[model samples]
Target: MTYTSRIDLSDHVRKQACALLQARLSDALDLEAQAKQAHWNVKGPHFLQLHQLFDSVHDEIEQFVDLLAERITTLGHVADGRITTTASATTLYGYPLEATGGEAHLKALAGSLGAFGKAVRVGIDQAGTIGDADTADLFTQISRETDKQLWFLEAHLQAH
Candidate 1:
């Protein structure tokens, strides 16, 4: 349900933006948990580096979670961030529970980041098409940061 708000955007636009934000929020929450899983389970020679990097990724995703949820509320919609909501709504492929090595976790996390980044890029265009420049800009900011995070994850997977 949407609440009454003073924002100039029409109810239709706000509802569309909120739905977009909610979907991304679920993905962000799932990604954050996956990062933490990697951080906790990573082993092998590069344990320290992988552990730190995963933790950093988790922290960054937490910010995205907050941003998406707040944008939903600002659009006058409830931000459904409960764990069950995320589990059911997230578009990301499930992170492997048995992934224990640094390389394994890195690949898994990178896949998730790539998927989320792609979705956020789509969200940017969708928001713009729906006539919400602010939401589009918000997705743009998220897409940029998500790309950087994916780069960091990919760097470890590269042989060079």
Candidate 2:
């Protein structure tokens, strides 16, 4: 266990950081689920590419969830990675039950990436305000990765 009495933050600051990370982790989990859904249901000519892309996206999101959890736990707080916690904390729209073709799948994935990227950017800014530069850096890394995935997914939707 790591101890850092030197790092003194008000309860509000700590709470805010915890809340931000909790939100991020939740969003990451939601993204993972949606990506898996897309991976499983994607079809059409670009099936192979989209299927692989969604799996990559899911992996990235899962990594972010673990990183955020570790950071929150480092701050002397309990990290919640459970389904109920993620459902309550996430801001993502519900995943559709019906299977969709490549274009619809890309649209949904792109929208999700955009929303998750915005949240991560906001969280990074909030963490920086409280002097938590490391957390901000982590979110920055996450944002970049999300954007790359967004690019890859969006490219598949463009005209040939």
Candidate 3:
């Protein structure tokens, strides 16, 4: 698709916004995939609860992916969300394929969510700096939800 947006922001700003959005989109996709990997393979005494929690987190991250993709398109940029694209662009570390225990999966997810949440906060500032309040607000929303999910995941690892 051609860049034909007239959303008041300059082409430069749109290009920058698309870059910011696309980076986070890639991270979000990676996070979702990792969570699903945990969901499907986690096994332990707390397997049922962890499985359910990971599934819920996966669903929420899916929302972030959709929102980001739509925002990129709204800016008249093609959202390059292909797996190959995300795999290359994502900063999230690869989830261990051998990690099948609840504790291991929780640890992996908490770390990834923390990293992703940090990136989203930076994204909010970057978008706002480019005068894209809409994108900034969107990132704010995603950040809030990401933090919540991170809390849920980390809670499982907390020492009583």
Candidate 4:
């Protein structure tokens, strides 16, 4: 698709931004699926709590997915968020299907969120490098929110 924008960014920069956003979209989609997997399969004493937390995390990730998709569209690129595309493009580690315990789910979730947050930090730098402040700020916002979610998941692992 041909994209013409008044955003002042060069074609190369816009393409870069779209690629970056699409990559994050894949990660967000994968993360949401993993959270749902954890929510459904989670068991043990803290099952209810962990199930609820996973749902909440999934919801937040859905919003992030929307943000990323919209950003890609704003750049005039087709946002390829299909499950197949996400499964192929995502950098997230596979969620352990054998993990049924709350602690196990929490550990997996925290690791995924940490990985995502790290990627967002890199995205922020990449957007900045292209002189796309709006995209950089978007990544910054995502990074902060992802870090907060990671903290929430990790808090369950922290000692008193």
Q: Mark the 10 consecutive residues where model 2 has the least summed lDDT.
A: 1-10
- Extract clashing residue pairs from model 1: none
Pairs that collide in candidate 3 are: none
TM-score of every prediction relative to native: 0.98, 0.89, 0.96, 0.96
Best by lDDT: 1
Worst 10 residues of 3 by lDDT: 1-10
Candidate 3 runs further than 4 Å off: none
Q: Name the better of 1 and 4 by TM-score.
A: 1
lDDT of 4 at 16: 86
Candidate 2 yields a Cα-based lDDT of 0.84
lDDT of 3 by residue, 1-160 (tens): 5387668988888889999999999999999999999999999898888899999999999999999999999999999889999999999999999897888899998989999999999999999999999999999999999999998988878874
What lDDT tens digits, residue by residue, belong to model 1 across residues 32-85? 999999999999999999999999999999999999999999988999999999
List ranges where model 1 is wrong by over 4 Å: none
lDDT of each: 0.96, 0.84, 0.93, 0.90
Candidate 1's displacement at residue 155, Å, is 0.7
Q: What tens-digit string does per-residue lDDT give for candidate 2 at 1-160? A: 3334445765566677877888888888888999999999998998998899889988888888888898788776788889998888789887766657988888888898899999899888899998778778989999998889899888877866
